[model samples]
Target chain A: MLVRRFVRRIAQFLIVYGIGLAGLLGLKYVLALSDYVVPDISLILETAKEVIADYIPAVFSTLSVTILGQVISIILAFSVGIAGRKSSWLGSFIRVTAYNIQAYPIVALAPIIFILLGDGFISRLLIASMICYFPLLLSVLGVMAAPVRDIEHFYRATGRMTWQLEVKIRAFENLSKLTTVISGSATLAMAGTIVAEFVAANAGIGYSIRTALYQSDLAKIFVALFLIGIIISVYQGLLETVGTWIIQKTSTEASSHE
Target chain B: MNKKYALFTYILLFLPYSFLCLLIVTHSAQAKEHEIRYRLKWLFNTSVAGDIYANKAGYFAAQGLQVNIKEGSPEKNAINELELGRAEFGVASADQVIRALDKGARLVVLAQIFQVNPMQWIYRDDQPEIKTLNDLQGKTIGITFGGNDETIMRTLLTKAGIKEKEVKLSGVRFDFMPFFRRQVEVWPVYRNSQGVILQDKLTKEGEAVRFFNPAEFGVNFVANSIITSEEMLKEQPQVVEKFLTALLQGWEAAMNQENETKVLAAVKALDKNTDARIMQKQLASTRGLVLAEAEAKKIGAIDMPAWQQTEAIMLQAGQIKRAVQVEKYLQVR
Candidate 1:
């Protein structure tokens, strides 16, 4: 069984990676078809090095703020989502708030945060959290109340033999979906924070990009974009791994019950 | 007989004074309806270093325009604000103006504040291996976003005869300088600010960066343009003329010694962390750019041939898709 599992994993990895690599190569050629015009490559490289050295503290701090902010946002969203699903009043209120946040474009909130936080990290954190919070909340709440008709029957038959039955059995059942919602929102939050940071920051990847553009430094701009893309890509991979594990764990439990 | 004559004279003076007062108040009330809001390209910094001077110095008021300046997201956003009527005017580079005009936005350039592009190239002090653009062959280079900083790379690279894709492009983070220290060949910087900062820090440590100015290579382009909507131009010609005139006067006052110190003070009020000495140096650089066209008959001067030449450079370098008629965007109204 272990040998079979290993072989299957390798095959899956190879197939997915082969397709992805091909796509990346194709995209490069397409961009090259435009001749990939850039201004000040050497200058941009030097400036990027300069900004990184001077603003190392600010960059790390912004990254940490981005991670912590998503954590807080996810926790609050889950709590609110659970409560709303369980209670009618909160459901109405949460529905309204989520819709309101969704109505505004994520980037539009940057200036507001700038006014509140004076081009500070807190402002970026708040704006990013607000943008990501809505999607996470909706996903968690909707997944919790998802139409699994037999789930109620299973609970009825068990007749609350133990509180653990209610907490672990039903909640754990949707764990896969929960991680999906969380991971997606976390990635979205990262993008939102960068955009906010771009408009009102003195330091961070966003500010670096702006300075590069002003100087007509194309190399630095591309480098920044590449880094951001890598970060988001890694986050997505990790989340998908966790999601797969959760789904497998839940599936076995359901089959065992049968 | 003397008391009767004095009372008659007092009544005669009071009637004329009150009537003039009424006329002055009524005219001001009518003018108040026209508020010209401009969205600046950068934050309230030393660039618009003269705006507060313009306001407090009565430059805008003299022209019958109450101008409210706000910060913008710098590019397309500024254009959108003008289109949406959130801002009557927007500030950006001439390239952006060309792009906006192509997008079917009826905009006009009111003034050109920066005489030359401050965009430049930088290398570490005494890095012999990577001294010039030719040295960047087969090396890893850092870039922020390739699209925004359009022509600087193509101009420098093609001039040196470096083939496209010879140098590998790496992801840009705040770590540009680190890449340089760790052996990245070259970097882009603003000569006035970033270059100054690096120069100050390095020079103090007995180090300096080998720098190249894009303008020296015939890449003289304008930065920080003042632009307005065409609809506003048609409807409020008087307001536009008054605003442009006042803004020009404001620049004049800011450049003078006595008022310049005051203008610098206003810049400090907005950003407390910037050093005064640094600002002074920046002011000197700004002065040269602002006054480069001082001899011309017009205050906010536009060079058509130079613009066409820049467009041609980009075109020759295959950066721009097609030749853009530079005159369509610069309607001096």
Candidate 2:
């Protein structure tokens, strides 16, 4: 299942990336644009070959930040979502604050972040977490707030209901959705880190992209995008596989207990 | 019913005729005016005072040309716009032109605007003056990696026979905190624009600052220049001549110290955010760069040796794969 999922993700990314490249090439041909504007396939391939070695290390640096940021965002999102699941005023306040904080664009806040934190790992991580946190929180909140009425009623009537069991039941019932949201947020985390690097930081693939832009080298940019897309697809696929295993393991345990 | 149908047919035929007439009128007007788009290399500031002056003072109109002077940013590359058929003419740095040419972009240089490149380093007056290239040794200098400043700085260091480890090279962003905190002893800035602002701020704080111009140290990397597609120059040679003449005239008049106040007012209208005092100083600094005493009459002369040196510098720095023989592209009117 894991191998199949990984293969499927990689195939899907290649197809989409191929189509995008074809579209760009079509535009270039129709317009008769020089390599400076939209590079030909040969130029892109040559540039990719030239830059791949240097870019791999940069990509790994970005990937490391992306993984760390996603982990941090997931923890924060789950905590906030679970706490804000109730209908109390405190819960409402927490939800409102999360929404408001997410509304402020990260680009606008980046300068202050850089000033306070400097353009280092911390700022990139902070920006990445902030970017991916809100969406994950929204998904978690939706799942956690909706009660499993039929199951919850049985426990409540028998006076055996506890918050821990209640939370587990809700999470278990919505396991698929939680997994999807967490997996999807990885893309946002990657995007956030790239933006942080593009805007200020001196390292990472995004910084390389920025340098490529300075020289107006579209081929290098194309290569960078290809690597980023491939890496993120693999990551999302792994997340889904892990999620499937967890779902299968939990269901088997519950059946055995019964 | 038959009479009504005949009247409807007549109305439809008349509509087509009217549309054709309108198209012809617009075409004729455009032909008479010779409308073209001129993309600037940067935003509206003292750096582009003459460009602003040209439009405001009706220089293009005087030459029977209708030019839409578009402001430019890093993303709004003139070469791309030219290829995309969006702009007929533009201002690009020598490095950009050479790089574009290396990649098969058919661009031509019409004029070199800045005799002295405005990209320079600023340091506190208290620091030891870098009178010699060796004086740069051990100084923590800031350069925007992947920018022309970085190439120019590297070339300077190489000329001084200094290794990379000899001086601490700090990569800078748009932020100036590192420079302000004295963590980076030298910072790169456009001498006319950011240089003026920084100097003004430091001056107000009872501190003096000095600019270290690369040109002074014999690194004559060319800056901004007027450029057009090779096709435009070939097909519309007359129009190109008219546009270049009017642009050079606009630059000449704008740089004349006598027209300083009028030029300042024109620039102020476009750039409302900059302080009036800073704008004045920026324009004064720009005048010297744009029109050195010997080249005062020829505001837009193309410096051939500087262009060759610029190409050489880019080649040595690996900014370009090979020399594009940039001289072939420079069409000095």
Candidate 3:
């Protein structure tokens, strides 16, 4: 039954995506008939070749920044998230700060960041981390503090240490929520990395977009976007798989123990 | 045993001395390579061929300088970057310099790259000719809202006795489809780079394109010029001179007929998308703009009269509140 359900889900996704891809391909041809520049498969292939040869370094740079930022966010989320959930004062402070930081768009802070850090890998990394920082922290905190009566009574009755209760019991109970937050945060970090690269980077996908805009080369711009989309999709897909496996394993373990 | 202990002690002493010498050598080597950051007015293209060539051709390295060239977007203000000390040197247009001066950003112009501003309106030749500014009336023209093209177009319209209502100003957002579809009769493009590409594309579709140059009609808005913060000028005079000298040499080499292949190769490294054939034509146009009918010796020359005229035009357009002594900011060699 489980395998059949999973197959149905996969088929549903493939059908939807297949239709979307076909529609896009049809649109490309329709536009091509006019004087409008449209993306061709050959152009995409050529662009990919060029990017692999000349722009792979930038792709790696952006990935490195995103990975580093997401890792930092994971650390901050685990530590500060718990503190925020456990202490009312700390939680209020974290909420207010995160809200303020997230409210001010990264574009507005880019100049100040560029000034403070100078335009380099460090600035890009900071901007990416800043963006990824808040969402993960808030989600983890919210999940940890969620009032589940049964779990709460069990922890209290067992007289477990606060650390053990929070780390083992609470985290497992909220494993699925944590997984969703992490994947979203990772995507946010990728976006932040691109934005940072756009504002002040010397090289990267964002820089390529900027250059393409200046030249008004729509083909090159689309190519860069296509590459970036592929990258983000692959990264998110990996995260999703790992997240699902962990959630499944942990939930199964908890149910068996119960 | 006593001799072995003495030898070990001597080895330890020599290691420390050698390590100290290595540190001194490394520090001096690093010091020799004075790191400087330069920000461009626009992204990497043939427009910045000279600057990129300077770095790529070992001119900066030859001068014992390590230069980091940062590309700028339409949203980026090179003058602001210079003012904030994020970049030691930057490229700015006459309009931006005027605005920066009015806003109290102490920047000095180093070298004017494009002697003739390449910001011009491109129209399909099949359409009615825009030979005079009056011909532009009633036609939809594309302009980037906050760009130098907008400033130049506004100045020209005012000078031509055309009101805002007389001409339809369409705000362009990096999309050429509107222009291609004849939604905008005229579109702004850099004659050297984007203009060449546009013209080629249209020609392939059996449409001939012509550029309406503002300089030809006496507006003569100045384009990209090298700019450095006042503080950099005051403090690092030697470094500035060294950088300028090497940069000028690079520009000269890039523009030279014999070095076309080498220069274009360097440009292709930075701008991988532009076609080599189109780049050749763009390079030719770039050379014409930089030289501006002057002798080869006049490469990177600051056209003071042109600068004055540009400032006067900006003032007339009310782009700046007060008249700045533009001459005072020019550091022409």
Candidate 4:
């Protein structure tokens, strides 16, 4: 199942990438643009072959930060979401703060971050987390705040309901949604890391993209995009597989108890 | 009754035909203006003062051209716009031009804008003056890693017999905090625009700063130059010549010390965020970069050797796969 899921994800990404590339090539031909403007497929393939080895390490550097940031954001989002689930003043405040922070452009805040943290791994990680955190937080908050009242009523009526039990009931009931949100946030995490690198950081695929832009090599950029897309797809596929396993196992255990 | 009906029909037909003729005449008159789009390399500042001046001063109109001058950013590549049939002419740096040419872009260089490349390093006066290239040892220098500044600096270091480990290189962004905080001893800036602003800010704080120009150390990587696709030059040679003549004239007038105030006012209208004082200083610096005293008469002359040297530098730095004989593409009017 894992292998099939992973293969499916890779195939989906390849199809999307191919179509997008075809569209670009179509436009290039229609406009009769030079290779400098939009490179031909052969040039892209050649450049990809040349740059893949170097870009792999750069992509891994980006992935490491992306994974780290996503994990940090997940932990923070769940913590904040739980605290804010009660619809109390503190909860409302947290929601307002998250909305405000998300509304504020990350690029505008990047200079302050660079000033404080410098353009190192920390800055990239922080920016990535900040970008990926808010949406996750909002989703988690929505799930946690909306009660699974039908099932919770039984526990409440029996005087056996605790906060932990309430939280677990809501999370389990909305496992599909929670998993989808977590999986979706992976893309945001990767994008955030790339943006951080593009804006300031010296390392990663984003930096390589910036270099290619300076040299005006569209082929290198296309190659980088393919690698990033494939890697992120594999990651998201893994997360979904894990989520499925957990869901199945929990359902089986609950049925046995019944 | 039949005669009256026939007269009314003739009057209606005549009115429609007359209106059509008037419309055609108006359009033809407008077409005489020869509308074209000219994309600048960067934003509206002293760096593009001459371009803005040419439009504002009616130089283009005098040549029977209706030019729309567009502002450019890093993402808004003029060469791309040209290939997509959006822009007729554009200002591109030497590296950009060479890189595009190497990639099968049929572009031609019409004129060189900055006689002296404005890309230079700004350093605090407190630091030991870099009289020689060897003086750059052990200092943390800021470079936009993928930028032309990196290529130029690396060449300088190599020429000085300095290894990469001998000095620290920091990646630069839009912020100047690192340089302000003294974390970076030397920072790269365009001598006319950012250089003027940085100098002004430091001078106000009672800190003197000096610029280290690579040209003085025998590295002359060319800056922005006027470019157009080969098709435009080949098909409409007359239009190209007229455009070049008017542009060069506007640049000459804009660079003249006598016309500094007028040029500053024109630049100020487009770039209101800049301080009036800074604008004045920036224009002065631009005048120096655009035309040295000896070359004052030749504002837009294509510096062939500079172009060749720029190509050579890019090739040596591995920015280009092979040598693009840039001279063959240069159409010096």
Q: By DockQ, who's the top model here?
A: 2
What is the Cα-based lDDT of residue A245 in candidate 2?
86
lDDT of 4 by residue, A138-191 (tens): 999999999898999999999999999999999999998998999899999999
lDDT minimum window of 10 residues, candidate 2 chain B: B24-33
| Model 1 per-residue lDDT tens digits across residues B104-145 | 456778887766666666666666655456876786654444
Across residues A84-179, which tens digit of lDDT does each residue of candidate 3 receive? Answer: 776578788987787787899888898788766656789888989988998888887787667566867777788864665656677877788888
Tell me the spans in candidate 2 whose CA falls farther than 4 Å from its real position. B1-34, B293-297
lDDT of 2 by residue, B1-333 (tens): 999998897566455555654553454234224568889988889899988888889998898889998899889999988887778999999999999999999999999888899999999999999999899999999998889999999999999999999999998988899999999999999999999999998999888999999988889999999999999999999899989888888888898889989999999999999999999999999988888644343788888988999999999988888889999999876
Which residue pairs overlap in candidate 2's backbone? none
Candidate 2 at residue B264, lDDT?
Answer: 93
Q: Which parts of model 4 are misplaced by more than 4 Å?
A: B1-33
- Write the number of the candidate with greater TM-score, choosing between 1 and 2: 2
Ranking by TM-score: 4, 2, 1, 3
TM-score of each: 0.57, 0.93, 0.53, 0.93
DockQ comparisons of all candidates to the true complex: 0.02, 0.27, 0.03, 0.25
In candidate 3 chain B, where is summed lDDT lowest over 10 consecutive residues? B24-33
Worst 10 residues of 4 chain A by lDDT: A22-31
DockQ of candidate 1 against the true complex? 0.02
